[model samples]
Target: MVIIEAKGLTKDYGNLRAVDHVDFQIKKGECFGFLGPNGAGKTTIMRMFYSLVVPTGGYIKIFGMDLNRHASYIKSRLGILPQDNNLDLELTTLKNLIVYARYFGISSSKSKRKAEELLEYVGLTEKAHVNIRNLSGGMQRALLLARALINDPEILILDEPTTGLDPHSRLNVWNKLNELKEKNTTLILTTHYMEEAERLCDRVAIMDRGKIVAIDTPENLMGIYGGNLEDVYLKLTGKKLKEENNVENNKS
Candidate 1:
């Protein structure tokens, strides 16, 4: 049930390599995590998979189709919740959903019905008519989640899905993600939060300096590294502050 296969994937930005030759596979109905600190190129790799950014080299296949040749078809079955909120501030919560559904070619009436169901699913039914500007950050996150589901995609790609939320809101989002997993939805998530990755991912790939340094289950990674996921992450990545200071000193 391998839904995604990436072989020797690489991306370069001028002289800088954002994603170095990397390889990975994600199976159907599994929660896979990409973990790393800033500038690790996790997002760059994920963006390549989604076809937002073309790979500098190598191949990517989704659902048995070549990513480069069938990007539109692949995108049709993929749901993405990017790190930043891209919602239209002037639109109502329901309107946002309706607009997204149209991209999938769903009829207006059908899209409206689906939007309502999604709003209810995300506990935003009460705020269906509320403008995006008025909703709390948590509510907005929930709305994004709901919008991602409007097309009923088989694969969900979330980038820092719960970033910048309160504890309760984060929990709510996590619960919803779990529910989706129960329904056999395959998920690929990128996050800096070790706890979130540990809690949600069946397997995590730790990337650093544009390459994958480790890939294993949370428990195994922690066990092998002699501590929790955070400790393992730090051990693998070293201290970011020191790296930053070194760069600063080099400049001086």
Candidate 2:
């Protein structure tokens, strides 16, 4: 049932090593999360999972199949939502999903049906014909989510899935994610939101500077570290003050 296995996974951009020899395993149907400060290689690892980046060392296997040999098969079963919005501005909300579904070789008729179903599921039926640029931030986020699920993927890979949404919108997305997990879909998510990670992830791996510094269930990790997930994370990574600086810089 080990759905994801990373053995000394490493990625480097010239002399700048983004992901070091990191190792982790994720079980089938488990909500596994990756947490880290900005530029901590969380994105690099995420990109590697979806074959966006070639690694400098080590290897990964998904569903017991070596990623190098079976990337197409592995990707066929994946649903990905990147941290940044990448919707087609020229396409209507429904069309976005329809086009993405076509990449999976879904029949045109089935793709249209799937698009309509997902649009309604995300509560965007009214705006299904709206241009992507005209939708509100929250609405667009929901649409992006709907697009990810259009293919009915077995493994959902979400990077900052609920970022930039209001509390209401965030909760809605959270509920949808919970429903997906209930149906036994394996999820891998990366987020700066500790609360989201604690709420959704059965286990989380805290990465710092291209390496996994800690990995455990939220409760067990908190128990072992004698604090909340954020506190435990700060203690292990020793980046509380640095993170604060980064936040301040972003605001300014």
Candidate 3:
């Protein structure tokens, strides 16, 4: 089953087009990746999927329903981990999860139980009672991930899901996400980490200047371009050494 279908998807900010004539289809249980530099409109495409921003022109269908008509239902089935750290700092880790779970109408008892399980799953059980302020950057990202999964939605839209994590922490989250994939969850991801996409995504779309420049399985993309993802990116989009260094710096 095709979980998502988009054609001619476009988004504009005044004179600048943030996403231009994008098109893609994601299978029900496959991992689809969106890769690009900062401000390449990857986030804009993601926001469109979750109906956070209305598109200027396009057609989208989620779960066989029109995006325009079924946005509420579609959003209800989406789990989103935005790039920004938007966790409620005033609340404890457990409270943070429980409160967000309430948005999906989960019962208090069930939310608490699921919160406990996720805290354990994300390796944050020991810090569940701690305030968000005291947690490390990586721990907070993990908690946000756990919060995104509290409802067990059919689709997960992850934006740089491992952005703030150490190598060990990032690996742990990767394993958990792979487990979810094994259970047939559709995932849409946006990230600057080519290796992460290569490891996790069944296929990826490369975007530049609000447009999709390429789309294929990671291996095929490499083969067609005669190099690795970074090479392909550089060839197609023209990599800047400073930008490359910045990505490396942030990943560490």
Error of 3 at 40 (Å): 0.8
lDDT (tens digit, per residue) of candidate 2 on 127-228: 989999999988888898898898788999999888779999999999999999999999999987888999999999988888999899999999998778
Cα shift from native, residue 199, model 1 (Å): 0.6
Weakest lDDT window of 10 consecutive positions for candidate 2: 240-249
Error of 3 at 103 (Å): 0.6
Local accuracy by lDDT, each model:
0.89, 0.88, 0.89
TM-score of each: 0.94, 0.96, 0.94
How well is each residue in 148-207 modelled by candidate 1, as lDDT tens digits?
998899999999898789999999999999999999999999987788998999999998
What TM-score quantifies how close candidate 3 is to the native fold?
Answer: 0.94
- As a whole number from 0 to 100, the lDDT of residue 241 in candidate 3 is 23
